[model samples]
Target chain A: MAKQAPGVRIDGLTVVYKTPAGELPAVRDVTLTLEPGTITGIVGESGSGKSTMALSLLNAVQPPGRIAAGSVEIDGLGDVVGLRGEELRKARGKHIGYVFQAAQNSLNPLKTVGKQLLDLGRSHGVDDLRGLVREAKELLGRMGLDGARVLDSHQHELSGGMRQRVGIMLALVLNAHLVVLDEPTTALDMITQANILKIVREVHAERGLTTLVITHDIGVVAEVADRLAVMYGGRLVEQGPTRHVLGAPRHPYTRGLIRAIPRLVGDIAEAQALPGRPPTLATVPKEGCVFRERCPLRMDVCDTVDPEAHADGARAVACHAVTVKEHA
Target chain B: MVVIARRLAGHLARGVVMILVVATISFFIVRSIPGDPIAAHTQKLIEQGMAPEAAEQATRVLYGFQATGSLWEQYGDYVAGLLTFDLGQSVTHAGAPVTEVLGEAAKWTVLPVLAGTLLSFLVGIILGVYAAVKRSGKLGDVLAVSGSLLHGVPQYVLGLLLSAIFATLIPILPGDGPVDILYEPGFNAGYIGSLAEHAVLPVATYTLAAYGGWVLAMKSSVVTVLGDDFILAAELRGMKRSIVFRYIARNAILPLFTILALSLGLLLGGAVFIERIFNYPGLGLLLIESITMRDYALMGGAFLLITVSIIVANILADLFYSVIDPRVRSGEEVSA
Candidate 1:
C-alpha cells in the first residue's frame, strides 16, 4: 500500500561536530526541500557534509556531532529536530526510512534476514509480525529476489546487489513515505550499480516516495534523481532540476565535479581531476567561500565573504560572481 | 542434521587424536624423570632391615608395575591400558586406581572451578558491556581500571589475600580442606554447608583472578561492535533502546565465546596453585602430589585429563559458534 508521499522542508540546518579544538560546523545553514513524490540527490565529495545533512532528517547525527541549528519539517511529522527519546525513535522507521551507506555491512551478520526483520517489527510495536514478514517478502519479491530464500539467508550469503535490494525492502516494508538512501551504490560493479539505481527509481515511483539519495558520484544522481543539490565544504553550493544542473552548472564547484567524471566516449584527456583536496572539518573556512581556493573565477571578495544560495526560478546557485552577473 | 552429525564426528575424531598425542608424550616424559618410586621405596624398606628381594617384591606390589620392563615395553603396556579405559594404579596411594583417585579429587575441583569461572564470565560480561556503553563516563573508567588490576594479580596471590581476610583474620569460614571431617559425609546440611564454606575462598580466588580479563575483553569487543555500521543502522531504524542493546550485545559476545571455552579448558590446569593455597583437594593438588611422589601413572592421567578437557571445550566452542552465527555454518557457500 502506498501512502501520499510527504515533502520535507529543511531550513537553516546547521550541524556541528565537537572536536578537540572546538565545535565546528559540518553543515552550515543549508536550506533545501524534497517536494512530495520526487527523488532529490545531493552530490558531494568526502567531507562535504552531504551525509550530515541527510542524518539531520531523522535527527540521527551521533555524539561528537549534533544538529546545532536546524528545522527539518516533514508533512504530518512536525519539526523532527524537536523529537527526542522514544518519540524521536518511533518517528525514524515509521515516518522516515534510511537505507544506510554500505548496505552490505548493514545487516547483522549473526542474524538471518527474517529474524532481523522480525526484530525491527517488534521494536516498532507492530502487532502483526506475520503481516510485516509478508510485506517484507512482497517488497523483496518486487525487487526481483527470491523473497523466502533471501529472508532465510544471512548477509554474507547475499551478493552486494542482493543486499542493497534487501536494504531497500527493509526501508519500505514499514510503508514510510520519506526514504533516504545514502551512497546506495558505492561499492558495486557498474552493471550492478545501474541495476540498483533502476530498482530504486521504480520503487520510488511505485511506492509514491519522496526520496533523498546522497552520494559522491555525479553519475548516480544523473541516472535517478529528479532534482540535484551540490554540496561543498558543508554548504549547498547549487540546487536545480537534474537535467538543468547537468546541462548548465552555475557553481564553480559543481562544474569541476561534473568535469572530473570519466566518460567512456569522451577524449581521454578531456576528463580533468579537481585541483586541491576537499576541506575537512578543521580546514573548512570559518568565513569565506569554501570552494574559492580551487575556483578559477575567484575574485578578491570571494576571499572574505561567503555567498548565500540565491534562488532564481527553479534553480539556485550560491556565488558572488553569479549573483553579480544575474543582477547586471 | 547431516551437517551437524558430520561436524560432530569431525570434532570427536580430532579430539581423540589430540588426546592420544598428548598422552603418548606425557607417558615418556614422566618415565624419564630421575628416581623411580618403586626403587626408592624398595631401598627404604631394605634400610629398615628387610631382605633386599622381599623389599623389592613388596615395592613392586605397592607400586603396581614391573620395574624391569624397558621404556618401549612400558609405553606399549600404557597404550594397551589406555585402549581398555584403564589409567593404571596410583604409586602414592598404594592400591588405588589413578582414575578412582583423580575422579574423587575431580569431584571437589570441577564443580567449584566451573562455578567460579562461569560466575566470573557472567559478571564480567555484564559489567564489561556497561563499561563499554559508558566508555566516556566515570563508572566505565573505574570498572576498566579495576578489571585491569584484578587481571594482573596472580590467582594464588588473590587466594592468599582472600584466605587472609575471610579465614585467618576473621575466622568466619574454614581455612582449608574440602569438608570438615566431623560432619558425616552424606547429604546432610552440616556436611554440605561445611563443603560450601570450604569452597568459598578457592572459588572466590578463581573468580577474582579471571573476572578482570573477561571484563576487559568484553569491553573491547563491545567497543568494536558499537562501531559497526549495523549497530548505527539499528539505532537509526527506530529500534527501541533495549532492542539496540540486545543487537550490540549479541554481536559483541561472539568472539568471546571461543576465549571463554579456552579459559574454561585451561583453568583446570591453572587451578593447581589456587587449590594448593587453599588446600582444596582438586585435580591440581592431586597432580602436584603425584609429581612430588613420582607417581607417573597419576601424573600422566592428570595431564591427559587436562588435554582432553581443553580439546572438548574447543570443539564445543566451534559447534556453538556455528549455531549462533549462521555465517560460520555455510562458510563455503558464503565464499561461493
Candidate 2:
C-alpha cells in the first residue's frame, strides 16, 4: 500500500454557522488529503461549503461561522483546531498562505504595498533588511508587474489585474507549505485569470509548494489542477484524479455540473441546466441523500436511506446507484 | 509633503472665498434690522449737552457713517475701514476700537475651547477604543449604553447640574468669570492656580458635552475596522494584536476626526449656553451684549471673527484629512 505524501489532511471536518434562525451546518463530515507539490481543486456551486472548508485551514472563518467538529493537520505543523492565540497566529501564514476571493480589497488601501510586504517579512523575524527589500521587489517583478512602482503606490493606484497578481505575490512571499487560493481568479478578466494560472503553475514547479484551488467554475480549475474534489450540499460527493473525474463523473451531481458548462461548438439548447437550487443546510433531507430532491437518478431506495462513499484506488464517489468493482 | 502643501494651498484659497461670502451676508443681515448705530450715538452725544447739529456731525465723522448716502456707500466705507485694519468704533463704548473689544473676548473663548477640545479627544478616544477591544462582555455593554445615554443629555443641563454639585454645593471651584479678582491677574503660580480653578467648571462642562459623540463614533468605527480584511491579513502575517490595533485604530478614527474639528469651531464661537451657565467671560457673552445694544461695529466684528474661525477650522480639517488618509492624498490614483 502507498502512503499519501506529506501535505494537508482535513478529516471529519464539520463547520456550523450560528445564524439568527438557528445553528446551521455549512460543511459536514468532509475528509480530503492534499499531497505535497500537487494542485488539488475543490469545485462546487456557490453554497456548497467549498470555501468554508478552505478557510478552515487558517481558522479564518468570519463571525457567526465556526468549526463545530474536526481537525486540520499540515505535514509537521500538528493540529490546527487546537492552536490558539499567538500560537494560532504564528502557524497561519507560516503554515498556509491564503489568497482571498476579492483581489481589489486584498491589499489595505491606506498603506503602500512595500510597507505591507516589509512588515509581513519583518513580523516573521527576517533580519536581512536590504536583501528582504530586494526580494520583495523581485517577487512582484516575477509576477510581470512594475515592482518598484507598486511598492510606492497605494492599492487603488493599481489596475484590477495588477492588484490580483500582487495578491498572489503576497501569499507566496511567506512561502507556506500549502497555498490555499479561494476563487483567486473569480473577479479578474479572462486575460488576467490565464496569467494568474500560469504564474501559479510556475511558482508551484519552482518551489514545490502544495496548492489548493477552490473555485465554482470547474472549467477554470481544470486547466491547472492535478486532482479534483466535487462538493454538493456541504458534503464531498466525489474526488479523484482531475482528468479521470472530469472524463467520467460517477455521481449524478458532478455529471450535471460538467454538463452545465456551455461549449462554444455545442448546441445551446442541449446544455443540461441543473433544475433545482442547492439545498440550504436546514432543508437538507434527514431520511435520505441530501441531493435526492434534485438528483435525476433518485430511486425509491434513495429516498429511504443515505449513501456512503465507495472507494476504488484514489477515486471515491457517494452514489448508491453506481455499483463498484473491487480493484484487482 | 508636496501633496499636503498643494491641498493646504487649495483650501486656503477656498477659505478666503468663504470668509468673503460670510462677511457679505452678515453685513446685509445686520443692516436689514431697524436700528442705526450713528443715530443712537448722536442721541448719546446730544444728551451730553452738545448741540443737535454738532452731535450729529461729530457722530458721523467719528463712526465714518454717512447718513445722506446710499446703503452701498456705507458698505464701501465699512470695507475701506476693514482693509486698513479699522473695524470702526463701538457705539456704546465711547469710541473704543471694535478690534480691541473682539480681541479681548477672543482670548477668553479660545482658552476654554482649546482645553476642552483636547480633553474630550483624549478621554473619548481612549474610552471608545478600550470599550470596543475589551472582552466584549458585561463591561463593554455598560460602556456602550452609558456613553450614548450621557450624549443624549444636553450640554447646558449637564453644566447646570455640575455647577450645582461642584460650584455651589461643595464650593470646590469658582462659578463665575474666567479668574478671581483678588488674584491681581499675574503669571505667578497663585494667579495661574486661581485661573485654572475658575476654568474647571467650564472646561468640565464642555468636555462632558462634547466627548460623547467621539466615544460613540470611535466605538462603531473601530468595530467596523476590526472586521476589515486588512486586519485579518495583518493577523495572518503573525503580528501581535497590539500591532494590528495601531494600524486598525488609525483608519477607524478618521470619521471622528472631522466631527471633532467641526465641534471645535462651534465651541470657539463661544459655546454660548455653556459660557453663560458658568458665567465664563467669552465671545458668547460679548455676542449677547452686542445684540442687545445693537452696537453694529462691535456685533459685526464679533460675528465676523466667529465665521472666520469656523472657516479656518474646516479648511484645517480638509488639509489634515488628506495628510492622514492616503485615499484622499493621492486622489489621482484612486479608482484607477
Clashing pairs in 1: none
- What is candidate 2's DockQ? 0.51
Q: What local distance difference test score does each model get?
A: 0.90, 0.81
TM-score of model 1 vs. true structure: 0.96
- The top-ranked prediction according to lDDT is 1
Specify the poorest-scoring 10-residue window by lDDT in model 2 chain B.
B327-336
Model 1's interface RMSD:
1.1
Choose the strongest candidate by TM-score: 1
Which parts of model 2 are misplaced by more than 4 Å?
A1-6, A300-305, A323-328, B1-3, B37-70, B134-136, B333-336
Q: Each candidate's TM vs. the true structure?
A: 0.96, 0.92
